[model samples]
Target: MRMILMGLGVVGRSFLRTLIEKSPELRLKYGLNPTLVAVADSSSAVQDERGLDPKEILDLKVRKGSLSGHAREVGMRGVELIRGVDAEVLIDVTPSNFKTGEPSLSYIKAALNTGKHVITASKGPFALEMPALIEMFQESGLHLLFSGTVGGGVPFVRFVRKCLIGERVLAIKGVLNGTTNYILTRMEAGLSFESALREAPGTGLR
Candidate 1:
């Protein structure tokens, strides 16, 4: 699978690192060879039709704090970048903009219209436009995956789709936000809500 990754934040960087580490295993066990052909951050974007080095991209982001330092950086971003890149899939780990469902929403629409599948971790788009997005993806005959939006790594969405085929779900209940769950845990352990909030940033919870 050829891919374009947008958003170079913590989730994006970590995803690149993990993809590099698991490349061999993915190919050997699943016959899946995922090549990152493009990457983009808020400031800049980069592309190579053959393939872009995930490590090089990750290192540039970590060292310089922006993809602008990359030699392949381009002027395009968001929807324009998505349309320009030649890739089978677009992985969007962009930050959530719940109120507007912006950038990522626009990016997803562009990718589908241009015949690219999508895998997104960003929640805002789905939260605000699930029905429309799903309809678009269906009409395009492309995959639209958002497993990371709700469960991080738990595959909760997949479980619901596969296991609950015949069953009708009346109610769903669980703690979905990790930051809020951590704060609640701390409060249960006797810390005040204010103290938990103060400690959250330092612990990288929020």
Candidate 2:
């Protein structure tokens, strides 16, 4: 699978590491030869028509902050770069901007316009521009998958959209804040909010 990665944060770095570790199994079992064609952050990107070295990129990213810090023969910024790549799939894992969806939204739209399938974890573009994106992807026979958008791996959207396809959705209400829920759970165990927060590893959905 020829793919372009749009972000190199915690999730992106982990994805790269896991992809490298599982490449052999992926090819042997699933007959999928995954290749990292391009990698980008908010600043700049590195592209190789054949494939970029994932380890090298990851190491550079770890040493030097953003992708632009890496010494490169080629690089580009903004949505124009998305259109320049020749890849079958564009992985959009950039940070979500529920309010604006700026670069990520533009990147997804531009990639889809170029006939590349989009697989996004960002909820901003998908939540705000779903109608338009779905229309465009459907028209072009490409996918706009947002499997990791909400509630972590809870499958909340799938359960509502797929499992309850025929049923009507009247109201959606629940404790969406994992941090608050965790704190509340700890509070029940006689710990205060601040104590719970300090005890917890990191703030979630805050």
* Number of the predicted model whose TM-score against the real structure is largest: 1
Q: Taking the tens digit of each residue's C-alpha lDDT, what string does model 2 give over 86-195?
A: 88998887777889987689988888778888887787887688898889888888888776776653667778878999998899887764556777899999998888
Give the candidate number with the greatest lDDT.
1
Query: Taking the tens digit of each residue's C-alpha lDDT, what string does model 1 give over 1-206?
Result: 99999988878888998999999999999999999988988889998888999999988888988888677878888899899888999999888889988889999999998999999988899889999999988887999999888754468999999999899999988887767887899999999999998887654345
Task: State, as a TM-score between 0 and 1, how close model 2 is to the true structure.
Answer: 0.80
User: Model 1: how far is 89 from its true place, Å?
Assistant: 0.3
Residue 99's C-alpha lDDT in candidate 1?
A: 93
Model 1 TM-score, 2 decimals:
0.90
